[model samples]
Target: MKAARGSVVSKKGVPWGTIISVVAVVALAAVVVTYYLVQSAPKRALASWAPTADNPDPSLNIPGIVTGQYQASVHILPTERVAYDHSPPYGGPHDGYWAACNGVVYPVAVRTENMVHSLEHGAVWIAYNPDQVSGDALNTLKSKVEGKPYTMMSPYPGLDSAVSLQSWGHQLKVGSATDERIDQFITALRTNQNTYPEVGASCDALGAGAFDPDNPPPFDPTPPGPDAKPMDYQGSAGTQQDTGMPSSAPTS
Candidate 1:
């Protein structure tokens, strides 16, 4: 059989077929060579002077900006990941916001505004904020709605059983940030929350013993307005996120 013009030889005298086989072999060789080149290429390393475990931020670089709407560059995921997805805390990852605030490292949760910054370097955790019923107990409520009708998806339009709690925590809280800002340019994203035993929201003791000692609770931490850019800090992993307590109310 006459092979195509590019073919110079044939396997068992099958000329055109030999041309196809030769092309296939060449393609495979190219792929192998490309793979090796990629594997052998010099890696791009961070600056030699870059921070290390011993001195994390030598020049004081701000790291891990998670909650301003951009997805976390780093995240706290379940230790054991499944086949294709992360096994996040709570019934699902979304629950952490309404109920998952506890999963957030206390320092991160308190940052409330600069969430991503915390997720970047600090330890991540999960815990649920148990809802309390105050004011009135109405009867006509069939199943009693059982605890705040709590679902991760509440307070948002997009999610189904999947909701972004960390998103809500930032969005709903006073002086919170808008989701679009962080999310706009992000390429990858995930939200995380864990649970912890219930802690008292308020205390009666005054002075150093009070543990906040305010009513309806000074428990909520609202971030400074989006425009209130965060300042840099030089401290331990935990202190990096410290905006301190949100002033019970920011002074005008």
Candidate 2:
């Protein structure tokens, strides 16, 4: 039907394809932004809580954190153990050989004495009660320690809490692996110059005969015998070289 000279042509349906494409792009952009925020939020929070002269021990601000005044440079032999005042002790006399705490996660319970030495070297030890933590809960704790220097995690049988974090003279026990205080404790104490005894100590194992991370010494759950080393017992002079002490004076 040939109409008059100029008939108006009307365009009917909406541009559905174009609209859908725009919506998809917008959704993808939103997801990317959300992920960035989620990943960086914790780091930002930790930076704010970093230790400063005014806040010498920022871990003190963390709720339920237990602080102690254990003397440094105290080391015991591998065959000896200390009658630690606290369960999964935060500090005190420790084994002469420090555990391999450079982001190592032990599948079995490690000797507390060796682990405590790692703490003195400014490493944060994450001890979880195997009976209480497993599966996702266990993995969640591992995520905080694995591949993160100055950090290590191990199963501690008979642990009073589901999770316990130890760094030098500090300790924090939480009921679950998802506790926010876990990161806070790590941020404040791991390698904090004022808190730990050794400032720039190495978290690596000495070697095969020393503290082997793969086949480390088994944790003895038995109560420390009467002959166990006392808290005030000064360490042997032979092991002092491994304390990471600078040629100058040592810090508390």
lDDT of all predictions: 0.24, 0.86
- lDDT, candidate 2, 30-79, per-residue tens: 99999999999889878867899889888888989888988877776678
lDDT of 2: 0.86
For model 1, residues 212-232, the per-residue Cα lDDT tens digits are 112211222232344332222
- Alpha-carbon deviation at 1 in model 1, angstroms: 22
* Candidate 2 similarity to native, TM-score: 0.82
**Which candidate wins on lDDT?**
2
The TM-score values for the models, in the order shown, are 0.20, 0.82
Off by over 4 Å in 2: 1-35, 237-240, 243-252
